[model samples]
Target: MILERHGLGWAGLAIGLIAPFFIATPYALNLMTTAAIFVMLAVGLNIVVGYCGLLDLGYAAFFAVGAYTSGILSTELGLPLIATVPAVLVVTVLAGLVIGGPTLRLRSDYLAIVTLGFGEIIRIVATNLDITGGPSGIFGIPGLFGDALSGPVALYYMVVVTAAIAVVLAARLGRSRLGRAWRFIREDEDAAEASGVRTYRVKMAAYVAGAVWGGLAGVLFAAQLSAISPAGFTFLHSALVLMAVVLGGMGSTPGVVLGAVVISLLPEALRGLADGRYFVFGILLIVMMLIRPQGLWPYRSREHGTSTPQEAREPERARMEGTL
Candidate 1:
């Protein structure tokens, strides 16, 4: 099963590598790059919402934190885009601790409401801050690869590689012992606590992991646009990321990636409909929910020590022969 999964991943990577050959247009590359970044965001959120069962409605806050941190550092200090990653990581980790430390204690609706508020606060602060360039946002941010290979195609390839790595890492984490702890908490926090799992610490770890992923994606976003703005990190943005996780099947890595790609590209694919595209999109989403409430790719656990159908039937057959 692991080999099969890895084969699928390699196949996906091969497709991404050759995509430019078929549709090398700048617009196409830019859109594909954005979709890849969305995939990263969705996967990150999956760690919190999918694996850990934390309902976070303000995930975009971390994204903003990373983007603003990287943008401000690069634009103001004249640092290269790559150099700001360490700072972005630090700031995002702090943001996770500060936010998750207090909020993780609350469950369900309360946690969601608080996270929503935090997302709004981050956006408002960015709008009001001079360093963030107020409503206009920070502009002229540096590119990811600098002048070494400064082209849309090169940037697209770079973003794809980074997104791919993020997905793989998240998948690996989901299979680790820490991941099992997360699932335990998700299914029943009280039970997880009784099992000697430190639920609080485990939850915090998931939040911090998710925040780091979002932050890194933010750096890519800033590099792609060469700008960072309050408008980009809104409540709607957070909702969309959450939607991708839900629609893709929470806890299912491939599902989340597929969900993100569909969400990101569907609108553009419907450009012919123009003004009515969103309306149609809404209808499609509604239809999808009705058809597959479980999600496009729901996660299924592989149970240990489960008897095969044939094996079970053999026992039944023996019993029947003895009775006869």
Candidate 2:
């Protein structure tokens, strides 16, 4: 378990270090950067969907909030993107708390509906509000690290660094005590509460954390686009982000990253596949689902102090276990 958990981090670091050398094409570099950003989104959502087993249908609302907050502040107020980080955090957390607090008491479809409505509310507000520039959206939002480091390549590096940090923080949190609480809630909320876990609070925490994560990804998105609008934060966007988490193998960091990369880049890569490519792609997705319903790399369970699966009692083996 230790090796399984740490191995992905080591591999990610190694890949990030070495990828720049092989990927010189600007298009390819952009794809990688976008993948990293989506990976951040997936990791954050994993906290809710993977660990906590919450069906968050509106994750992208937080992302839009972060993006819009940074875009508006940076353009209208003449602040740098860096200055907008705190606002992004505050808005996302409050949004999460407000949305999650009430709906979390409800289960399944009911909770999903409230979250979905919250998503639409965010998008519509951005569309109708003058401060959000209405449908025209904000433009010329500043880039990261100021003008001195605003080159496309330089911004790519910035993304690589920050995205890495986000990924690390999320994975660490997932392995912590709270993560266990989330899992317990996911599996059986009442049982977890009976066992002294505060199901309501933990669920709220998970929702807030996931919201913060989606919001951070939005900040990065704003930095990348240097613009914001209601058009950009749509229901499809939320579905895509959620799809990445699901297809990637919930609760598995590496699998989520792989899933994000594949989902984000597949369209670009499929440019050569012609008009019917989507047909093939859809077929492929179906095959993947049929084969790996749990995920491409499912989180495994084990007995203590052993690397193998716990099996049914084998009387003969137990008797010979006197070798202990």
Candidate 3:
């Protein structure tokens, strides 16, 4: 399974590298770049929603925080775009703590509601603040590679590389010790706690990880657009990202990436349908859910010969009774 996954990863990287050579149109590059950023966002949210089972409706707040932070520093402080990354990381971590600290305690619908409210609060705050340009948003931001490598092709390659790295890192996290703790909480929080897992801290770590991912994606977004407005980071944005994660198999990294690409590019592919495209898209989503509610690529355990707790304990009990 690991070898197959690595093979697929290599194939994907080859395709991304060669795509520009085949379809080098500016519009196509821009669209592909946007889709890559969306992949990052969906993968990030997967850490919180898919891995830790935390439904975060305010995930876009971290995206906004990252974009605005990078935009403000670059435009106001006259810092280069790359220089703002450290600051973006710092602000996003703080934003995660501020929002996740209080809300991670709640479960299910309550947690979702609070997160939705927090997402709105962040948007409203950005809209009203003069520093954020009072809904006009920041403009004339610097390029990702500055004046040295400033074309659409350069930007596209840079974004693809960054997104690929993000996906790999997220996948690695999913296989780490921390990732196991998250899955434990997701499977059964009470059981995890009983087993000595620090549920709150584990959830917090997931939230922070997701926040950092979203924030980095935002920086990429800001670099791509060269400007941003409050209107860009709406609840709709968060919903679309969540949809990608759901449509792609929540805990399956490859599935999430494929889902994100499909969600991001499908509408564009349906442009010929005109205004009815959205209606068609909606119907398609409904059909898809009904057909494969588990997701496009539902997560499956790769570990072979693994036994359930009951099965493992049975051997111990038999041994205790000299029945082994």
Candidate 4:
């Protein structure tokens, strides 16, 4: 089964590599590229919400921080966008720690509320800060790849490679020991704690990891658009990312990718529906929730132990009777 899954992943990567050859227009390429970036965001959020089971509504704050970090470094310091990646990574991780350290202690709705407030706070601060260009945000940002490979087609390929790596990394992380810890916490925090897992630390790690991914996506966003505003990192952006993870299948990498692609492309595909497009979209989402709540590609757990409660209990009972 694992081998089959690996083969499927490689095949998907192969198709993505050749996708541009079939696309005819720059607009189409742009849309595809955007979808790829969005996929990264969804994958990142999946670490926190899907794998770790922490609800984060302020994910876009990390995205904005990355974009702004790269934007500032590139425009003001005369650094290349590629050169700013290290700083972006550092800043994002710190941002995650700053927010997650205090807020992860809260459970359920309270955590969500705090995250939501943090997201708005980041946007508002960006809007008022001069370094972020106030309300206008940053512009004249350099490309990730220089003149050697700066065309739309080239950038589209670049984004495709980055997104593929991000997804693969998320999937790999989900299978690691740390990933198992995240699953434990997600399933039951109290049980996870009793099992010797440092629940707070594990949750923080997931949040930081998600922040890194979101920030990297932001770097791509800045490079793609060469400009960003507070408007780009709003609550709606965070909600959409959450929706992608939920709609796809939380903790399922391929499902999250499919969900992100659908969410990104569906609106464009439904543009011809005129004024009824959104209505149709809503209905489709509702239908999907009703019929396939687990998601289009739900995660399939590999571990299957045969020990049943009765079977295990029989041995204990026999041992007790013998002792008596």
For residues 192-224, what per-residue lDDT tens digits would candidate 4 score against the true structure?
676567889999999999999999999999989
Candidate 2 lDDT by residue in tens digits, 1-324: 322357776787678767878887887777777887888888888889887888988888998889988888888788878888999999999999888888899899988888888899999989999998998998898886557677767767777788778777777776677866776677667667766777889989999999998888888888887887888888888888888878877776666777777778776777788997877777877888799886776554322332111221232123223321
1-324, model 1: which lDDT tens digit per residue? Answer: 121275776887799889999995789889999999999999999999998899999999999999999999998898878889999999999999999999999999999999999999999999998888999999898787566666888888989999998998999898777877777677667766765777899999999999999999999999999988899999999999999999988887887888999999998999999899999998999899899887887765533322222232333233323332
For model 4 the local lDDT of residue 155 reads 86
Worst 10 residues of 3 by lDDT: 315-324
Which 10-residue window of candidate 4 scores lowest in summed lDDT? 305-314
Better of 1 and 3 by lDDT: 1
lDDT (CA) for every model shown? 0.86, 0.77, 0.86, 0.86
- Which pairs of residues collide in model 1? none
TM-score of each: 0.92, 0.89, 0.93, 0.92
Report the candidate with higher TM-score, 1 versus 2: 1
Off by over 4 Å in 2: 1-5, 302-324
Top-TM-score structure, candidate number: 3
As for lDDT, the candidate ahead, 2 or 4, is 4
Residue 96 CA displacement from its true place in model 1, Å: 0.2
Clashes, model 2: 0
Backbone clashes in each candidate structure, one number apiece? 0, 0, 0, 0
Error (Å) of candidate 2 at residue 218 is 0.8
